[model samples]
Target: MIEEIDSMKNLQNEVGRNARLVGRILDRLREKGKLNEGVPLENGGLIKIELNHIANETVKEHFLEIANDNRILAVALNLFHEEQKKENPMPVILVSKDVIMRVKADTLGISSQDYLSDKIKNYDALYTGFITVFVHPSTIDSFYTEKHLPKSQVPELKETIDIYPNQFVIFKDSFGSNKSAVARYNKYTDSFEHLYSPESVWDVSPRNVQQRMAMDLLVNDSIPIVTLTGKSGTGKSLLALAWELSKVLDEKVYNKLLIARPIVPMGNDIGYLPGDKEEKLKPWMKPIYDNFEYIFRNRKTDTNIEDVIAGIKNIEIEALTYIRGRSIPKQFIIIDEAQNLTRHEIKTTISRVGESSKIVLLGDPEQIDNPYLDATSNGLTQVVEKFKESKLSGHVTLIKGERSKVAELAAKLL
Candidate 1:
C-alpha cells in the first residue's frame, strides 16, 4: 500500500512541475508579444530590437528570408518598415528612429516600435540651429537694425539653442503679430542681414532665402554647378525655370537652355511600362510642361507654339541616357526632378557641363523616386549638403508651398 502511495505522489509532483514550466513559458511570450501601451505599432504584435538602420542588398535579402521562415515568430529590428512587405510577408514588426520608415511600415501593414525609450533629440532644432526667443515689441526694430544683442540679454534665450548663420529667429512677443526672421550672413557686407529689411538682394525674400542663395550662386557665374532642394510645390522646378529664363532670354547670359527630369515611377519597375523613351518620359515630364506653360503664358500671344518649340530645340530637352558623349557650351542647364538620380548619374550629368555652362539641379529630397536613396543620402541632398558652406555654392529651402491653400493643407495632413 505504501509503495502504491509513493508512486501516486511522484506522479502528482511531476504534474505540478510541468504546470509551473508552462506558466513560465506563457509569461515570457506575453512579455515579448504584447506591444507597449501608446506605442504606435500598427498591428500590436511586435518585439522591438536594436539593429543597423542601413543594410546592404545581400544583408537585406538575407534578413527577409529569415523573416519569412514560419518557425521564427519574433523579430528584433533596429529599424522597422511597414513597406518592407515585399520580402517579409509574415506578421513582422520594426523598431527604428526613422519617422518615414515607421510611416511606411504602418502603410504596409507591419508592426513597429521605437528602439529607445529615452527622450529623443528634436531633429528640427538640431538640423537648423534655431533658438526660440521672446522680445519686447518695442525692441523688434532695434534688433533688426543692429545685429548685436547684449551679452547679458543672451542668457534669457532658451536652453539647447543652436547657433548657425542660416538659422531662423522667432520673436514671440506678447503681441499677436509675432515676426520670424532668418539670420543671413552676408560675406559681401561683412555683417549679418536680419532678413527683415531690404539690406541685400539676398535678404529681401524671407520665404525662399535658400533658393535665392542658389540663384545668386548661378548668377555669379563663378561656379559651373548649383543644386536646389525642397519639398514638392516648394518652388524647386519653378525657381530653376525662372533662373534659366532670366539668364537665357532677358540677360542673354547664355546662348541656350537645356532641361530634363528622370522617368521613374512609384513602387514599380520601368521595364513593365509600354512605349518608347519619349512616351515613358512624357508622364514624368508633365510637371516640367506645367512650368513652361505658366512661364510662356503671356509670350504665347505674339509667339506661336511652333516658335516656342523651335526655341526649346535650341535649348535641348533630351533623356539622361542621351546626354552622354554630348558636349554642351554656353548653356544654362536645369535638371528637374533630380532626386531620382543616383550619385553616379549626377556625376555624369555634372561632368557634361562644358566650359562657360551653368547647371542647376532641383528636386525634393523627401520625395525621392529612387529605391536605393533616401532623404539624407540622395544625390540632390548630398550635393546641397556638401556644397552649402562653400562660397561658390548655396542652397535654399522653400518653406511656404505657395501653390494653393488646399495643397498646403494636403501636404500638412495627408
Candidate 2:
C-alpha cells in the first residue's frame, strides 16, 4: 500500500500533470485499477494507493509542536502516525530524500531512513577506473618494447583482478619494486596498451598519471562519455575545460563547447542576489572562467581576462535548465558540479546528447551541496559506476591536487 496526504500539494501537482517518475508511476497505477488507485503486479500482488486528508486532532497537535512551518512534512508525518494506529499495524517507516525530514521523523518517534534504492553500497570500494598489478620485470620491458602485452602473458596477475573495459593497470615488478609502467586495458584485443606520454592541451600538461589517463579519454574520439571526480584542487574542471577548449578550438573535433552546471545553491538561491540569468550564473561559473584565464595566461603571457573571454567564440555557458527539449549534437558538452544532480536528471541530460557529441561530467563527490544527495547517491557517482564497464565511456578519479600546496593541504587535513 502506498499512503500519501491530500495536503501534499507537490504530490497532487505531479499526479495532475502526469509528469516526473512519481507521477508516471501513479498514472500506471491508475491505468491498472478501475478506481484509479491501485496497481496489480505480475506476481498477483496488488498495491493500493491511499490519500489521507489532514483532520486528526492528535496529528494537528504533532504538527503544531513539530512541523508548524512545514505543512507537507506535517501531513506526511500525520499519515505515518495514522498508519501506525491500524488494528494489524505494520511497521511504518518514513522514507525521505530530505535529511531534515528524516530528522523530524526521528524527533516524532517515527522510524525513518534515506531512500536507498539507487544508493551504492560501500562507496569506498567504488570503482577508481584503475588498479595495480604486479608482474615479472620482463613484462614491463615487453610492454615498452612491443607497445602492448596480451593479458594471458601476465602470469602473476591474479584471475580475480576484475579488470573492466578501458580500465588502467599499473604494472609493477613486485611489491615496492621501482620498475613500473602504466597501461590501459583494451577489452577488444584483450591486452594492455602502453600509456601515451602526457600531452599539452592548450599549453596545460597533465601533472600526474591519473590526469594523463583523463586526457587520453577526454581527447579520444572513440569514447564519447568521460567522468572525472576528485577533490577541489585536483584539477577536474581545469583538465576537462582545457581538453574541451583544445578539442573545439585546436583540433576542431567538435563544433562547439557547451558548458553547464546544476543551479543548486550552497546556502541561498542565486535568484536572491538580484541579477539576470547570466549575471546570476557568474558566481557559479567563476571557477570555469578562472580555468579559461589560466589557459590564456599560459598560452600568452600578456593575455587579459577580457581578451581570453572574447577569443572564445565557440563556447556557450548556460544553465542545465535550458538543455532539456534540445538536441545537442556534434558538441563537446561539459557538465560541471554534476554531483548536485539526481539520477533521473543525469539520465535526462545524457539522453539529450545527439549524434557525435561527447559529454564530460566533472565534479567532486565529497563537495556536493545538494541536500537530497550524497556521495553514494549523487548522479556523478552513478554515472561513474554505471559506465565503468562500457567501452564507449571512461572514468578517472583524480587524487593529486594541482591547484596549490595550500589547497591540497586543506583538501586533506581540513
Candidate 3:
C-alpha cells in the first residue's frame, strides 16, 4: 500500500472504518516508518521458496499449478512445518479463508481451518422467525373465534419445537380441510395472537406469507429491532423503507429517519472522499431514493405524488461513519445491506441507538461483499440468531421474489 505514494488509503481517514485484517501489522510497520533495507529479524528473514517439480502434469496441475500468492503461502507454511516438527512439540496449522490455501495445507500434512470464532454453525438451518404447524381443524376454528390461542393448545409446542418471541405461526388443519389461520407468538401472554396491523401503505401490500409476517413486525411498536433477510428482489429493503416512511412522515412515531449502510462499493471500507458527506453518499443512496420514488409514483397515488414526496421531511440517507457517536433518539433507523457489516461493526451501529428509537436491519445474507465475512458470519445472520428470543426484537425471512417475472426467474435459476 505504501509503495507508490499516490492517491490511496490515508491512515487518518481509515480510523474505525477500514477492514481489521492487516491493520495490526500495518500499525507495527507504521511505527518504524522507514525500515532498514538490508536488516533482518533475529530469528528469520523473508526467503523465496521455489516450486517443486514433478513428472505427472495432471497431479501437478491440481497441486500448486496456479502458483498464486495463496499457493505460495501454503507451500511456505508446509515447508516451515516440516522443519519445525523435529524441534518444537507443537502443531503447525494454517488459518485462512482461501479454499485453495486450506486444501493445499491439509494435503501437505498441515492442519488447516477457516476462522471459526465468529462463524455460525449450521447456517443453512438459520431461524426464519416463522414456522407452519399442523393442528386439528377445531383449533383453527378456536383461533378465529377467540382471536388468540393459548400456547398449550398447540400440541406441537409441547414437543421438540422451541418457538421464539414474536415468532409468526401458520396454523393449518392436519386433516384435508383448507382451514388455516396466521398468528404471532406473544411471549408476554404465552399465546398466538391474530395480526391486526393495517397491511396497506401507499397502495403497497405483502404478496406472500413471510412478507405478511415482516409487515406485522414492522408495524408493531413493541418490537424495536426488526431484521428482514432474503434473496435479491425479495423486497427486504422495500418493506423496511415503506414502513419507515409511514412511521416517520405519516404517523410521526419517531423524530427522524436515518438510513445508513456499509461503505463497501464506494471503495474498500468507508474510504476518504473529497466532497461533503452528503454529496459523497448521494451515489450510494440512489436505491433509497428510487424506492421513495416508486412508492410515491404508484398507480393509485399519482395525484398526491409530488406533494407527498416533495414535502417529505426528517429523512437522512448517509454512511454509517457519520452516525457512529451521535445520540440518535426517537428515530426510525434502517441499515441497508447489513450483510456486509462485521459483527463488531454491527454491534457499534446498534449501540448508537438512543431511547424510543427503532432500528431495522435489512439484507440478503447470501449476497455478501465483505471478504472477511460469509452468510453464516455476517452481521445480519449473526444478529438474527442472537436476538431470536428477545421480546424487543423481531425477524422475518422473506422468500419468493415478488419484484417481476424475470427477477424471480433470475433469483432461482441464476
Candidate 4:
C-alpha cells in the first residue's frame, strides 16, 4: 500500500547514486508483479499505482495554500485527499522526516508521524562508555600499590557500578577527597588495568582525563576499533590523527594512514560547485590538512606543508563514496564525521577492515548535517552502543573542548 507522488521522480532519477534501499524497494515491487502492472494478491487485494494530475483544482489550491513552500508535500496532500474521497476509504497516515511537513499535515487534519522504523529508542540514556565511582582511600591506595585489582576485591564497585568491557572509570576517593585515578575495566580478565600515559604524541598530549582514556584506546594494538563522540573543539579528530601519524611514522606499527569522510554537505551538495573530484573535495578536507600541518610543525620538520604532504608516501585521503567493495588491511583507518553516515553505511565501511588494521570513528552527533539522520539514528551512535561491551572495541565521549576558549564557549553556550 505504498503510494509515491509524481514529485518523487527527481528522487528516483538520483537513485543510482545513493538510494540502494530505494532500489531494493523497487526490486521487491517487481518481484511481487506490482512494479508496472498492478496485480491482485491471493486475498483479493490489489496494489494500485497512479500518476498525479490536476483532477481536483480545489484540493490542489487548498494544498498550495497550506504548504506553499514545499511542492512535493502539496502534491502529496492532494493525493491523500483524493484517496480519502474513495467509496471504502482506509486510514492514511503521512510518514515524513520533515517536521514542517508533519505540522502542515496536522493543520490540514491529516494524520502524520515521523519515520521511526530505523530510530533507536532510549537514545537519551545511551552509553557514555565511562563512569565515575567513589571508593575508600584504602582501596585507591591498594590500586596504586598493586598496579591492578580484581573485580571480586572491589566490593564497593558492585553497589554503584556495572562496568562494561574496556569502559574507563575514574576512581575518586569519596565525595570531598581530591585523590583520584583513572583505570579501564577489562571484562575478559576481570581486572582494572592502569592507564597508558604517553608523554606526547606528535607533541600533543591529552588535556583531560577523557582524552587520556581516548589515547589509551587509540594506541593499544589489541583493540581493533574505537569510537570517539564529542562536540567541536573536543580534539576527537586531532587525537585520532595524532595517534594515527604516531603509529605510522614514528612507531611503524601500521603500514599506512587512510582517512575517509562522507561527502555530505552542510547546505548544498558539492556537485553543484564547479570542479573535478579532488578540487571539489578541497573545501571538505581542509580540516584534515590543517591537522596534518599542525602535527608536522610540532615535529620540527624542515619542510613546507606541500613538501610534507608530497613526501608522505604512506598517507591517503579519499571520500567515503568509493570505499565500498574493497578490503583495507594493515592500515590505520580514520572515518571522520562518522555521524553523517547511516547504519547500513557504517556496517559496510567496518566490514572492509581487513586483518591487523584499526578503525577509528570520530564525530559529533549534535553537529550532524545529514537531513535523514538525527543524533539517535546516526551510525556513530549506533556503533558506540553496539560495541560497548565488545572486547575488541573501545569508546570515549570527550566532554571538554580544547580547540580554543571561544570555540569551547560556542560549543557549550550556542
Ten consecutive residues with minimal summed lDDT in candidate 4? 1-10
Candidate 3 per-residue lDDT, tens place, 331-355, comes to 9999999999888789989999999
Please give the distance, in angstroms, between residue 139's alpha carbon in candidate 1 and its true position after superposition. 11
Estimated TM-score for each candidate = 0.55, 0.85, 0.78, 0.83
Best-first order by TM-score: 2, 4, 3, 1
When 2 and 4 are scored with lDDT, the better candidate is 4
Candidates 2 and 4 compared by TM-score, better number: 2
Worst 10 residues of 3 by lDDT: 46-55
TM-score: the better of candidates 1 and 3: 3
- After TM-score superposition, the amount by which residue 151's alpha carbon in candidate 3 deviates from its true location, in angstroms, is 0.4
Question: Which scores better on TM-score, 1 or 4?
Answer: 4
Each model's C-alpha lDDT?
0.57, 0.80, 0.78, 0.82
- lDDT (tens digit, per residue) of candidate 1 on 1-414: 122233354353333444555555545655645423222334773333213333334335434443322112122232234325457644455656566656645544457666543222331321331334666665556556677443234334435233333333455564657454444443444333454322222112224555444445556566567666655666667667766776787788899999877766777665655789666666666677777666666562676443465556556666665687778888989888788776657777888888888888887767877775666555676566555455544455556675678877776776
Pairs of residues at least 3 apart in sequence or in different chains that clash in candidate 2: none
Per-residue lDDT of candidate 4, residues 1-414 (tens digit): 133333343563223334555555556667778644575656896654534622435445455453433454554566677778999877667777779878877876678899876666777777787888788887788889999988777777776555888998888888567998889998889999999978888888899998999999999999999999998999998899999989998899999999999988888664665679777777888889888887777567777665677579998888998898999999999999999999888999999999999999999988989887899888888999888879999999999999999999999998
- What is the overall TM-score of model 3 with all chains considered together? 0.78
- Model 2 lowest lDDT segment of ten: 1-10
